[model samples]
Target: MPGLDIREIVRAANDRWNAAFNSGDAAAVAALYTSDGTVLPPDHAVVKGTAAIADFWAGFISAGVKDHDIELLDAQDGGDMAYSSGKWWATGLGEDGKALRFEGTIVTIFRRQPDGSWKTCLHTWN
Candidate 1:
């Protein structure tokens, strides 16, 4: 097959991710990953597998994170695998009810599923 339009695919996936996160649905956010997906969160031990990934997101969602934004910078298809680089930012409320914010660069790998949809295989941001 010809090269996949990874830019479009990632754009749509990012939209879904932002929506899921903003809605505080950690399960929905984790559904964007592959079964064996891994997350390398800043300053934290690596989280492996979908369940752990869901738990990681659940913590953030429960912390009242919102307004998540992802800006895709680059993407390339490599047959069954692909990679994307981007920047992201989000806002949340701290335990003290003060506003908290975060922004960082991100790199993610995606694997094409049997159903022809893309899911995150590895994700890292800082």
Candidate 2:
């Protein structure tokens, strides 16, 4: 089979990731990963498993997290793998109108599946 384009794949991955986070549904975000995926958030222990990863996002969603923006900085593909690094920022407003801001970079690794779809195998955020 012909190889996937690194740039297009990376763009789609970033878009899907942004959508998942903006949705504020932990399950939705976690669904972007493979079944045995792992995620490392800055200063936090690694989160593994689909269920556990989904649960991890629950807190932010429950707190009404919203408005996430992701900007892709670089991407590369080699063999059966692809990776992308990007910066993201999000804002949240509480019922009392208190504002909160979060900014970070997402570095993700994707593995090509037999079905030709790329799924996240590892993710780390800063």
Candidate 3:
């Protein structure tokens, strides 16, 4: 962690996130998080734990959400914890069977693992 760059964390997490979410595999997306990770989706109740988090993302996938993208704006690390803020977008099919795009900003917190990798511990978007 001496020369640890936040971008490394960003890349590691974001790459897997985009792949899993876009493929509509909610469980894989949840696996990117820590065991007790939490997601605070805007306007929804607080979601904690990987099981609940998988269900949370499953709802979106089931609703036809796809093409998730994250544009990392900034990130910083303090000790074993780090966070990034960025813009995100996704496409979902509406009731009319037309594509609906949603864009927003998100902040994600990560914790360093023993193997020197990073896992998302917290995430929130609006």
Candidate 4:
């Protein structure tokens, strides 16, 4: 069995992410990650560090991105490491009149930080 439950972590992370993105607060979203965290975007190279992560997400914020109705597909826990897959749709002017649907997967390696918060040490996406 996994050492820590990942469902709650994923829920919290997604909540913060959705809130930050909808509010166009890139910095706040980035703050959810560790200082040396890693984010792998679909069309771009790996983004390392919190500053770079913020920069990478800047486009979405500037384009008025909106995420809604996130349906969690699966969650697998492996001690301090876990992954989740889900389907989400974003509807906004940036995506035209059509909603942008994505079958996304996120694998996160969690680290027990000094402050006792489970921070993402590494993250990869499809």
Candidate 5:
């Protein structure tokens, strides 16, 4: 791990997120966040804490969203915090039950856990 970089770290974190999300396990997705983690979803009210975040993700999963992906354009770490910014997208069911795509720029902040792993602290996208 001596040569591992911030980009690699962010990618690994996001990979775990995608795995949890794709599997339709909201609890697993929430586990990727810090205990007080929060999500600022587009055009929606802010969601905080692991439980609320789990329900938030459950809403999305129930709405038929899948194939969520992240493309880390930039990543940096300092002290006990790190952040990544880039493209994110997913497909979901529209009102007509047809495939609808959502894509946008996003930034995610993560905190270093006591065990040296990173957990999401904040996320916002537009």
Candidate 6:
């Protein structure tokens, strides 16, 4: 097979994740990660493993989060490993029905799977 385009792969993954998150499908969002993926969210302890990742996202979804957007800044392929850095933003309704918003920069490491798909191995954001 030809060499993979890291930017395209990561962009597609981000699109998929945004769709899943907007739809409130935490499991689908977690499926974009590797089996033993790790996530480090701002002001939270590290979450490891697919199950833990799914649960973490489930909490956000249940809290009425929506309208996620990911803007890819850079992505590079390094054999079986790749990395991408970007900015993300989202908006949702707060408990009092006011608009709540969040935006941050994210850096994620991805691993190429045997099936030629890229999955996030480490995701950290501030």
Best by TM-score: 5
Summarize candidate 2's per-residue lDDT along 1-126 as a digit string, tens digits. Answer: 356578788788778877888877778888888999998887788899899889887777777777877788998887689898898888877678899787888888998888888889998887
What TM-score does each of the candidates earn?
A: 0.93, 0.87, 0.93, 0.75, 0.96, 0.93
For candidate 3, the 10 contiguous residues with the lowest summed lDDT are 1-10
Best by lDDT: 5
Over 30-110, each residue of candidate 6 has an lDDT whose tens digit, in order, gives: 999999999999899999998999999999988877899999999998999999999999988877899989899999999
lDDT of 2 at 73: 90
| lDDT digits (tens) for residues 40-78 of candidate 5 | 998899999999999999999998999999998999988
| TM-score-best of 1 and 6 | 6
lDDT of 2: 0.83
**Runs in model 2 lying further than 4 Å from the true structure:** 1-4, 93-97
Candidate 3 lDDT over residue span 1-126, tens digit each: 457578876866898999999998999999999998999998899999999999999999998888999999999988689999999999988889888999999999999899888899999999
Residue 23 of model 5 has an lDDT of 94
Sort the predicted structures by lDDT, highest score first: 5, 1, 6, 3, 2, 4
Summarize candidate 4's per-residue lDDT along 1-126 as a digit string, tens digits: 134467777767667777887777888878878899898777888899989988877877676566643556676666555666666656556335565544455556666566556666676666
Q: Between 2 and 5, whose lDDT is larger? A: 5
Clash pairs (backbone) in predicted model 4 = none
Best of the two (1, 4) by lDDT: 1
lDDT of all predictions = 0.92, 0.83, 0.91, 0.69, 0.93, 0.91
Candidate 3: stretches off by over 4 Å: 1-4
Lowest lDDT 10-mer window, candidate 6? 1-10
Q: Write the per-residue lDDT of candidate 1 for residues 1-126, one digit (tens) a residue.
A: 236478999988899999998999999999999999999998999999989999999998887788999999999989899999999999988778899898999999999999888999999999
